[model samples]
Target: MDKFIETINWCSLRDIGFVGPRFTWLYRKSDGSQIRERLDGALVTSDWLNRFPSAKLFHLSSSASDHSPLSLRLVPKPRSRMAGKLFRFESMWLKEPRCAEIVQEAWGEGLREASSDVLGKCLESGDRNTRFFHAKASARYSKNLISGLMDAREVWQEEDSKVEEIVVDYYQTLFTSSNPSDFVELLQAVNPR
Candidate 1:
């Protein structure tokens, strides 16, 4: 095992961490002695790690064999558009000791500026942006507006008068109970579990 690890180190291959059980192979003896070992995994080169920073190795349960199966998942690199330019993540950046500190500092500065800008805009406007608000309200109203409705007889209604009648009739029928006292009979008929 030491020599094997030395070979892996010499090859510059790294193990992509696993997600499931610690042991991949299980052995049980008739005398009630059992052995468990992690013998299966995935190894990746630095280039592959750079390309797939979000790669994952899963240890799947095995029912027919003592050795569990391994599943490798490679997540594609994510690209984001920031200020009309593309931003990409490099896995090698994680090796830098100050990467986390630099990112946190930049994020904190940006967040402070953005928060102040938004608060200033809101304070200055103070709901005076009537056209934008009205437009959004009108858009929601238009989207929620029912163009047509189907009647109980399966007739399509497009006219405003007919649509209103259908809606009113629906609510009236829904609220006006024909047999209000029937709930007692329903409760009695339900068998206790």
Candidate 2:
């Protein structure tokens, strides 16, 4: 048993994790003291971990078997999430007495430049506005603030969800090709007859 333990330790294998309830194994003694331990689980090597970094384990309710049967899966990599709806700050927060104090404290500490990139971007967008000038000494801005927004892009495609599926399918084939010739062939094949 000791040599077997050493061999497992030396192999550098790690147990896959589980979510939900903690214990997996249970035993009861004649005197009524119960024993519970995570006796059943799967382990993987470094190579397996790198290949399936998002792998997970789940604990299930015991039927006839004392220990939970485990499952393993390697999921396809997910695409980058589209920027969704804007989150609005609550007006009630400003009404509270502590609001001023909290704001002053946060302001005193000063936000890091890296943390305020989005805010800086919105502020800097002022320069992107087109300026119009007339020969008669009139300076007016001709910026259409709503241009290039989602509603404009979505007009080209009736189904918004299909756009991502199309993009993902297109890129997956191109990127997964191992050879240049294969990529070129795949690209040519994508065009309709």
Candidate 3:
């Protein structure tokens, strides 16, 4: 149909970074008219295209459905495997009497006056350290909380009100007493300003 063709053309021109199979939708009527049109589409901004030059769109055929599937692919973003390993602190730093002092010392050392490049590196290191510490702390707290709940499984099995009360109190303590100072250094590292 004229409308379908116009729509495809309009989308193709308006959209940037389009690649792979062009057609999006295929239609066939019992009357024997086969119409294949690009009903589905994707558009990546110019900025994204420049940042991820190899990004591409993939079009797949539909075996059971009338519409074809569209997919986007790009190189996987890099991430640090050790970035959020939070449990380490539970065993290593949680009970250490000087843990707070150590953290403060590290914070001070990381942010001491330095060149722009050195400052940037220090900030990144601080951010990673903070993230790792917090993640571990949170995970430890959560695990303990879950264990406590599991211990009350028998009570909860008999009554829901008691379980709800325990849960409510746990959350109240968690939210109100949770300390952000533990990760302040990491936050400053990510945003020195």
Candidate 4:
């Protein structure tokens, strides 16, 4: 065991670029001689460390397994034209008198007796009310916009082009006013250069 530890320590010093918190792992055995030794290790090339400025290895406490898990947090490289933040609706918007009325009216009859045009109008008004409500609600919640954008970007990447286009169009409709110039300007303002 001593020889093994020495070999690992030497190899780690030579190969692992970043020497983090010395203690890496713990050990427990049913045997009378309970030994706690660093069982888990992390090794990264110098170039990899340089590439990921925020990268770090964390030795977590052992739960069920004898070996502790090593967590790596890497700072993603900057990208051009990141996704715009999603518009989050606030709960308070439901408290607004007009928004409350629109929601109540739209869902009142449950769209059973209404004609196609009536249903369409109700949906449009309901959508507008919901959007307004959420905007006000989001202000209070103070949700992280960057994280939301990152998640949306991931989804967009996995989707087909047509699906991605539809999502973009939907967001445009939800976030921008009816004015074309205003919409374009708003999009440019949110998108990265």
Candidate 5:
């Protein structure tokens, strides 16, 4: 068991956390003694998580088995009914000469630069409309505020220190890559003066 855990840590595989019952397995004895344990989970690498940020794992109920089944949903639930429509590929678009250019421009630096310039202009004129800018800033601050978070035990953490700790831990785990080898290679590639 220890070796298995060590190997999992060594490979940097993390559990793509699930929603539903806390325990996946339930054992009940005839003497009225019952034990519940979370023995099943979906382990995934950081790259898979990055590619599918909206992926979800759900613990489905079981009638015959001791362990509940896990359902993995790659696509997230749509916010609106219209958003749930299935996507269809248009073959005619392949025949368009400018299709490739349009696609490249959509993902290219040109759009990014334009958006940055707009934001820069807004900030430059922010002094002229101080109240408007202040209101916008206040609204963003309120929207981004972290009031509370749920802990590993599924308990809500509302205290200032606890909330801060949870937020920091979450970001740390999210940003930390599963593979350390890439970091080493990246560091070696940089020329130190």
Candidate 6:
């Protein structure tokens, strides 16, 4: 195992990494004792990593076999723009060295091709600029603006009109047309009978 790691490191290969079951290998002895450990993973060349930055390795359930099955799924293209699903990026990930490497590799080709490209640029720009990402992630502008129009259920059409109606009623109560007699009385406040 040591030799294998050494060889992979010497060759500049990187682990694609995986998620799911921590223990890939499980063994149960006749004495009623069981052992488990992560025994399966994939290592890849830099080129492969660059091509599939969002690629994920998921572990399948292990039943008859003690070793869990691993599968690789490529990151699909971003969804349609009109879907209203804006991308949210977390700046906390920038604190990790591996994250920077991933972002750098994702944009190493000198092209901002993927949605992740904006994130990589934000990280490279420095910590002070992280607010942009924070705002994007929070989406406060859109949310607050929509709040006055759309309610908690997100029913834009019906709720927006209801909100406008309520606002109109509120202002009308505050600034309703006043009687001219009230103004005439105020103008003659100092007059004697």
Q: lDDT, candidate 3, residue 171?
A: 82
lDDT score for candidate 5 against the true structure = 0.66
Instruction: Output candidate 4 Cα RMSD.
Output: 23.9
Worst 10 residues of 2 by lDDT: 133-142
For each candidate in turn, the TM-score is 0.40, 0.37, 0.31, 0.28, 0.42, 0.41
TM-score of 1: 0.40
Candidate 3 residue pairs in clash (backbone atoms < 3 Å): 86-136
Error in Å for residue 159 of model 3: 63
Model 1: colliding residue pairs = none
Candidate 2, residues 62-118: lDDT per residue as tens digits? Answer: 777767666554563343443663343434344444556565665687743332343
Off by over 4 Å in 4: 1-24, 29-33, 76-193
Model 3, poorest ten-residue lDDT window? Answer: 149-158
lDDT of 4 by residue, 1-193 (tens): 9996687566532222222334555555667565666656655543454455445455665568766667775755343345664433345444444665555565786742333344345456566564444344443332222211113333313234444566687788799876554467677679575
lDDT at 55 for candidate 5?
70
lDDT of 6 by residue, 8-54 (tens): 97986766666566778999999999999888888776566556655
Per-residue lDDT over 1-193 for candidate 1, one digit per residue giving the tens place of the 0 to 100 score: 9998999989868676676678999999999999999988887766666566556577878899999998876754242322353243444445445557666775877643333333344445564653444444444543454555668886756567787899999999989968666588889999999
User: Which residue segments of model 3 deviate by more than 4 Å?
Assistant: 1-14, 17-20, 76-193
Q: Indicate which candidate wins on TM-score.
A: 5
Compared with the true structure, all predictions reach lDDT values of: 0.66, 0.52, 0.52, 0.49, 0.66, 0.63
TM-score of 5: 0.42
lDDT winner between 4 and 5, please give it: 5
lDDT of 4: 0.49
State in Å the error of residue 170, model 3: 70
lDDT tens string, model 3, 54-86?
454556667888787777767643333336633
lDDT of 2 at 74: 59
The CA lDDT at 190 in model 3 is 100
Q: Which model, 2 or 6, shows the larger lDDT?
A: 6
